[model samples]
Target: MALQDQPAYLIKMRAKPGLGDKLFALATEGMEKSGSSDRFIIAREDADPDVLWNMEVFRSHEAKDAYENSPLADELRDEIIELLAEPPMRIEVHPYSALPDGPA
Candidate 1:
């Protein structure tokens, strides 16, 4: 498949007041230990410290689906639900990939 059509998952999460740090720590830990994502982009909103945006890219939809249903993912999902100020929002995105002019 062409790079631009690659399937990915984009998530928007909001932590409870004063709990952004804890949420970030948990997410980082999970991403580091997990093989579900080939790329991860995580950012905290500057204006709203309680907001987090995450973009996770995988090799395929199958890989993404597998990771979402794993035991570790289930545990993390439960934990995140408790830490959230409101329900988390997620959407599937097709991203443009493969650096065209870069060394790669």
Candidate 2:
């Protein structure tokens, strides 16, 4: 798909009760250390207050793969695992081809 047909890469996370906020915070912070992501959004599941999803958009497959394979990502994954009800699940999505002009 075209770069703009998709985000290049994404990570979908489902958080446990009372820990979504904390996990989200860590995820945001962790992204800075890698510096390869293009956009980040932590969304709460409307049906379940205790559930959350962290949507990450990368600049390219290589960038996303780099982050996924990096020590920083591994560190964050290990840390967040403790906060989850079960092991976090990962989903790769095709983001919108076009993003809004405002800050992502």
Candidate 3:
């Protein structure tokens, strides 16, 4: 998808030590219910195993909005916020193109 054709968001988070697994489980459940098939990337780059990155895509602004307003969204946000060691960093972007079999 071109930049103008897709809506995306990147949410970066850090969890308390030993909390990564729990967080990932909850996030997966939430995403599954969000009606979004967008892929995600999770990683740990520092000594702390808490660092995580979630990249999500929506077909359009309307689709994103609907997902955001859903009950699943509320549950997901609450679940994530409770597990965070700090507030998540969120960025919205428009993708120009997707890598082969990658984010689009």
Candidate 4:
């Protein structure tokens, strides 16, 4: 599949008070090692310090699915759940266009 055909997601999370930084660090590390994403950006909500957001672009739907179902993901999820204030929200999106370099 082409890079423009990649799968992407917007994930919103609310970390327990005082645990936002930890959550962000853990999630960032996971993404860096996941091998499923070509690029991912993680951010914190300015209005709500405990709120976190992640935009991930994966090579393919299959790659994303495989990573999500893998034991590594499970381990990370288990760790993440303990620091979350609530369940995360995930929105799937399609990439319609990108710069010459590609989607960031």
Candidate 5:
């Protein structure tokens, strides 16, 4: 399938003060262990040190749905919520395009 047509989400999280680093670590760990994602990127906001973002692309719609309903995902969500100052915000989309690797 075309990468541009894949299911994706941009998630925004607000970590409790002094917890951004810990949140980033957990997010990175989750990405490394993900089985259904085509790509995953976790980033921190420079201006807002306690804010984090995650861009995730799933391999397919089914993959995304299965992952969302899985026990592992539930566990991860519960863990992540503990560090958040408020509920996460999620924006769902299909990617128009992306570089396979970051810009030169």
Candidate 6:
């Protein structure tokens, strides 16, 4: 089924030294629990060693809310918080449409 009204969220994090691997592992676990592996992306920017970017897409705001309210999500948030040097930066974007000729 295609998502009718999905929203994209961009999350930027500043991590402590050597915490990237742990963060990625925790994110994977959280995504699995939320049934959102298809919408999760984690990337390390070459320009900054302490910076990581996380992008998540959901079918709607309600889906995002549900994931956030899940027990597994709470546990994952706590674990991620402990590993981060500061709070993550999150931005929401609207996906207007998709291209017809390319892979989504």
Which segments of candidate 6 are over 4 A away from where they belong? 1-4, 36-38, 98-104
Give lDDT tens digits, candidate 3, residues 9-102: 8888887778888988888777776776465555665666677887787867888898888888887889889899999999998666767685
lDDT of 1 by residue, 25-87 (tens): 998888877787777889999999889899987767777788878999999989988999998
Candidate 5 local lDDT, 1-104, one digit each (tens):
99977899999999999999999998888877768899888888899988999999999999999999988889889999999999999999889987678677
For candidate 6, the per-residue lDDT at 50 reads 67
In order of lDDT, best first, we have 4, 5, 1, 3, 6, 2
Each model's number of backbone clashes?
0, 1, 0, 0, 0, 0
lDDT tens string, model 6, 1-104?
Answer: 35436777788987778897788778767776787433667788888766778877776677778877888888888899988988899998755565445676
Ranking by TM-score: 5, 4, 1, 3, 6, 2
Worst 10 residues of 5 by lDDT: 95-104
Computed on alpha carbons, the lDDT of every model, listed in order, comes to 0.84, 0.72, 0.78, 0.91, 0.91, 0.76
Candidate 3: lDDT of 88?
93
Clashes of 2: 1
TM-score for each prediction?
0.87, 0.74, 0.83, 0.88, 0.91, 0.79
What tens digits encode model 4's per-residue C-alpha lDDT throughout 24-82?
99999999989999888899899998898998999899999999899999999999999
Index of the highest-TM-score prediction: 5
Clashing pairs in 4: none
lDDT of 2 by residue, 1-104 (tens): 36554444344566676787887788778877778877777677788755666777787777877887988889988998887787666776767555567875
lDDT of 6: 0.76
For lDDT, candidate 1 versus 4, the one ahead is 4
- Score residue 35 of candidate 6 by CA lDDT: 77
In lDDT terms, how accurate is model 1? 0.84
